[model samples]
Target: MSPTLQNEALQSRAEALGQSLPPLLAEAEMLAATLMLGEHGRRRAGSGDEFWQYRAAHQGDPARAIDWRRSARSDGHFIREREWQAAQSVTLWVDPAKSMAFSGGRERPPKGDRARLLALALAVLLLRGGERVGLAGLAQPRSGRSQIVRLAARLAGEPEAGDYGAPETAGMVGHGRAVFVSDFLGPIEPVEAALSRAADRGVRGALCQILDPAEEEFPFDGRVIFESMSGSMRHETQQAGELRSRYLARLAERKDRLSELARAVGWQFSTFHTGAPAQSALLWLYRALEGGR
Candidate 1:
């Protein structure tokens, strides 16, 4: 197929992915099952084994007098109902902005593509596990698995997010977890600020920094022109060897800074390369957040 046609096909697939399960969706299902093995009280609602506080026996109280054991001990019969907690809510904050589309060296699925895949996978996993999910992108407020297909379709048609990005805060609701999936290529301060805001609101979050393998290895040989993914700037490289050290140092610093930020704020942070299997990355992310302890 033609280049445009190929891209369109990929787009269509990504969108359908939200509602329709992919062949490899089993991996995500595995992760979800692992995360929610014993978790309950949300997806499947039924009379649970939980015993909450007793309430006043209202009119037409059961003859058994709920908490009859306690009533025999005392004098009053009180009705007891299980405290039902809604399912754990998880928000998939995907950086649907255009910047995520960068492919550092050669033609490969861009970082943005992987980001979308991760977000959708996570959402599916959570949904399967009986959790409500929220979505944020260069756009915002993509919520609920019911809307997953449409959200994915919209993201498929979206352009690369800008350097200065927007955030999704309005739709974040209920108590649960938040997962921010992005390369976070723009200004560091804003990204930190956004995370801080989420943290402040008691929204626990994790950050996944996606990168291209070539970006780290400095694979360009002789001469190359490097363009910024956000269309902000470009760099010309005469010899990749000469810039190797600088590139590595920057990479190291970025990793350290991200790790430190996550540590200080109690959010999990992880980095993944494009060539790495994204399913493995999801596992690694869960491990990092779970502390392996």
Candidate 2:
């Protein structure tokens, strides 16, 4: 093809990619705005010049550590603590497996859409608070408003060909934080391996499980044909309702196993349904990450 043709083709592709971004970005910004409305950014304790809070002096308190003015106003000695001003790097992984595209109905967004929105919204909050955010194994951690565009583009990239998605652990920085958002209907072994590897690298984070309401409530009754989102696995059942007990049991077991895995790795885990408001998950994620640090 000629140079002009090549440039035109590239421009066309770029425009097509840009088209998918605004809705996700706008919705994410709106969702993030609701949380940012009446709240100040997260604050935690560490070594810094700015004062965080005052607490009673501990057993090993030195004379110099006590705040004379604050102590005089109080019954006991108080030590001034400073807020942690150092910024943190947060890497996020939103599962791109075809499974995440599943939606039980037309009323709500797909699991994949919800996952991306939450990821982007969380990134907006993190960036606003002066932290570096990136997509795990895809984008390196960087802080700036422009990074959100890159993240949204990457999040909208091609989906992996599989019935489920696995967390990507490569290229993770040691002692950094990460967030893995997925339906996690895949084999537990991959999830275990990813978390274990992250733990070895001292990468603590959270697991936000996004699922469709239909998947959670097994509402199918009569004859039903169930197939993986990738169409790689299929099963025909005469009575889908009968399998609800088994399905629910397995789901419970998976949740328990995930919780256990998270605990073992010094991480946190939470579940979000597509049917619920996105703010709840974003808030939990924001707090969970802040607390983890």
Candidate 3:
């Protein structure tokens, strides 16, 4: 590309990002406001510092673990237990692939937009709860309102040139959790490799597959030209409807594979469509993280 063309492309991308950033941030905040804030309770006693509850002292309970004052008030000896605190660092990855920019119609936003919204909203809740959140491979995990702005800017900046996206796991926090948002239309090797690396580091997380309604329902009929969002792959089919079965089959297979991979690595997996409300996915991600603890 010529210098003039490259500059023009950069300017266009900047303008697009500027246009999208404010609404994305506003929507994320609104979505996050609907949820309760504070550190999520693990509901079980472990090695955490925060006191969860007082239970009757067990036969084998250590003398130091007993609460003498509480025991005096109670008929039986009591033990103060601390809640389990795990997954301190949460890394988020929203797919930057051009395919994630696809939307089925004017009514719904792009898959990438939904993914970013979910990621940011979840971050807001996590940050409020004192969890460090960051963009995978782009930013170090930090907790603050400022991190939300940093994430939104990065998410709206530019689209990657590819048909699909892959997770970046090199700098993953050991024993920390991660959330990866992608369409997962790419080959399975990259996804498998990334999760394997994460597992090796004792990192477990969630995989959110964002898709367009058209991709799942296969509403196209008759002749259609199917081209990738990056314009790198294309196919002209006279009987688009006839290929629906094969396309749906492949999609199901991919989803099954993702689910299996997630299970193998002790992670959670979910599928969300652009047509649905974003809050549901955000809620699911929040609960999944809390449950993992």
Candidate 4:
């Protein structure tokens, strides 16, 4: 596509993304709040204004290290220790390829929407916990709510380019975490190569495979015309149900390979279906970051 046309397409997509933000943002916040009520609530250590704990004054302590008021209450002086100031940067990517546009039915949201929603919602949770978040292949990692807003805008506005697969991360630096949200239905070799590259940079992250219920269930019967999203392949079958067993087996094999790849690199892998609540995936994602597994 020409640059001007690409720009226009990006703007149009961004506008469409913007229209969905209010609801998505609200849902994300709600999920975060719900998770916070449980034992897995937001726990982050950073050099922020929040007080972490108080420790006894140690040798070589600066004259100003003592808490005078606390000293007055006890013979020993105490020094307040604030939370760790350093924030970890997390780069996120959601495949926006044509395949992601598939929803299987008119009543369901596209796989791309689910991927984008999970990516943004995870960003919200991370930002709230004082971590830097960025959209992989789109923007640099940044912290605070502003970063979330900027990411949402970018996600909404950018038109997907390139074939369906992993987003390039060659320009990214640091050993911090990364999150890839996608249907992951593409060929395995390229995906493995991309992830291997990221691992070479000391980057460890999670792979979240988001798929439509139909994709998982293969709930079709009678004659069906299966079309490829990239318009490169198509298959017409008189007995669609007959393909279900083989389809599911291939999917299982794909997921198994992906899981093995992640394990070999000491990363994490997860799968989410659109029919389920998004919060479950978001919560799992948050915990994965915490455990680094």
Candidate 5:
């Protein structure tokens, strides 16, 4: 998109998302730009199929890696050949369940909206990068611009109200990279199990855990009412100071468990609370991935 259109797009997005969107979009854009420059995926270098310069050979270099045609035209000393394939396919999975729509901490957008903007922003990056990007709910097909528009419309219309594991994922398998976005407020173990399932199937992926800062720190200062996004759980809070330490411990456990599960399943996991400007986490991750982190 033109820089003007891009800014307008982001502004439109932020407006739709209430107030907590600018930071999220900024983060996602930074991530998108960094991801394109990263080594993990085939990047679009101007023309869709134009050849780019090569790097030095590395260990276990495959015979296919050698560009014989190029070598025939130059001093052939390297055996490791890196061909720029078409832009790598990227599939983004977003959880639209009501739980993901939870909103807190000084009128932040609901988690669902944040996740949508996040996904859309990434889609903008991917599409702009000439990558064939698809957007899917838990179990949906490879989406196109129309599908993404539908997703955006869904966000604009209902905001939230959906199931987490819709069994649609069984049919979709991204050959390259899959990005999973969710709040993960539900029983965390099941989500890990799902990730494990994906890993066993050879699906390389990353997870961006979108969270409301309220979940990280029990910010309730007085008699506060707490409700679950799932609509089946609720807790009345009259005292947070007494529970702060315990809550912090549990939160720490949650973080550790998420990290462990991600490591165990071979997926990169990141946690982002609502209070943070999304750009930092997204850029940090983009830089890490670019650096092969």
Candidate 6:
């Protein structure tokens, strides 16, 4: 493409993103608000009202360690703990590969958009819960709600070169979790490899497979021409209906393999369709993190 055409394309993309972002952010915040009302609140030990436990005051116990009411009833003085002290860091990665740009219908959002929304919403929830959030291969895990807008901006921007597939785990050094949001439609080897490396580093996390409704249902009929996002492959089917069964079978096989890989690495795996409510995926992710797997 010529430079002028490239600029026009970029401008068009920017405009589309601007139109879509407000709704996405609003929906995400609404979902987060609902989740906050439930038990999905922060589980980490921090400044909170909920009671965790009480233990015998030790030698290094601070002067404020005594719980007056509880200590009065007990022979030994005890210190109260709200919860675990360390706040977890979660690294999120949404596949920005060309394939994610495909949408089955005009009404449906692209898989990439859905993935970005989920990643951002999940980040919102995590930040609210006092956990650090970071974008895999892009940003370092950091705390505070301010990072949310920065993440949103990066998601709307064009993908950088080599920004494809699962993220690299080399920079994830702590015992933090990693969340991978993607279609996971490509070969399984790279996914497996990336999860393996993170597992080796003691980073447990979850995998969310975002798919278009048509992709999951294979709702095509009659004639159809399928072209690869990279334009490297093409297939034409005269009876698209006839291929549905085979396509579905292959998709199921892929999901099964992904599940097995996730299990092997002690990570959780779940699937979400763009047509479904985003809250469901966010809830599942929040629970998975709470489960501390």
Which has the better TM-score: candidate 5, or candidate 6? 6
Global lDDT of each candidate: 0.64, 0.90, 0.88, 0.79, 0.60, 0.81
Clashes of each: 5, 0, 0, 5, 5, 0
* lDDT value for model 5: 0.60
User: Between which residue pairs do clashes occur in model 2?
Assistant: none
What shift in Å separates residue 292 of candidate 2 from its native position after superposition?
A: 0.9
In the range 1-293, model 6's lDDT, one tens digit per residue, is 99999999989998988886677777667777776644335555566677778878899879686797888997889888786545678898888887788788888888888888888888888887678888877788888878887777667767543424655664575678998888898778889889988988889999999999988998889999988777767899899999999999999999999899999988999899988887888889888877763
Residue 169 deviation, candidate 1, in Å?
Answer: 3.7
Candidate 4 residue 210 Cα shift, in angstroms, is 0.5
What tens-digit string does per-residue lDDT give for candidate 5 at 203-260? 6666778888877777777687677666666788788567888988977887778778
* lDDT ranking, best first: 2, 3, 6, 4, 1, 5
What TM-score fits each model? 0.67, 0.92, 0.90, 0.78, 0.68, 0.80
Model 6 clash pairs are none
Better of 1 and 3 by lDDT: 3
- What is the Cα-based TM-score of model 4? 0.78
Lowest lDDT block of 10, candidate 2? 36-45
Q: Between candidates 1 and 5, which one is better according to lDDT? A: 1
| Candidate 3 C-alpha error for residue 182, in Å | 0.5
After superposition, candidate 5 runs with Cα above 4 Å error: 1-76, 79-83, 137-151, 154-168, 284-293
Which tens-of-lDDT digit does each residue in 1-293 have in candidate 1? 99999999988866765544443344444545554535333322235566666777788977774787766766777776764555655666667676777786565668877776777666665555455666653334344566555445544555544653544554554345677777765667867776677767777668888888877687766787877666677888788678888878988887888788777767788888888777777766555433411
Write one digit per residue (lDDT tens) for candidate 2, span 3-50: 999999889878877898888899999999999634324477686677
Best by lDDT: 2
**Model 5 per-residue lDDT at 186:** 58
- lDDT assessment of candidate 1: 0.64
Candidate 3 accuracy as TM-score: 0.90
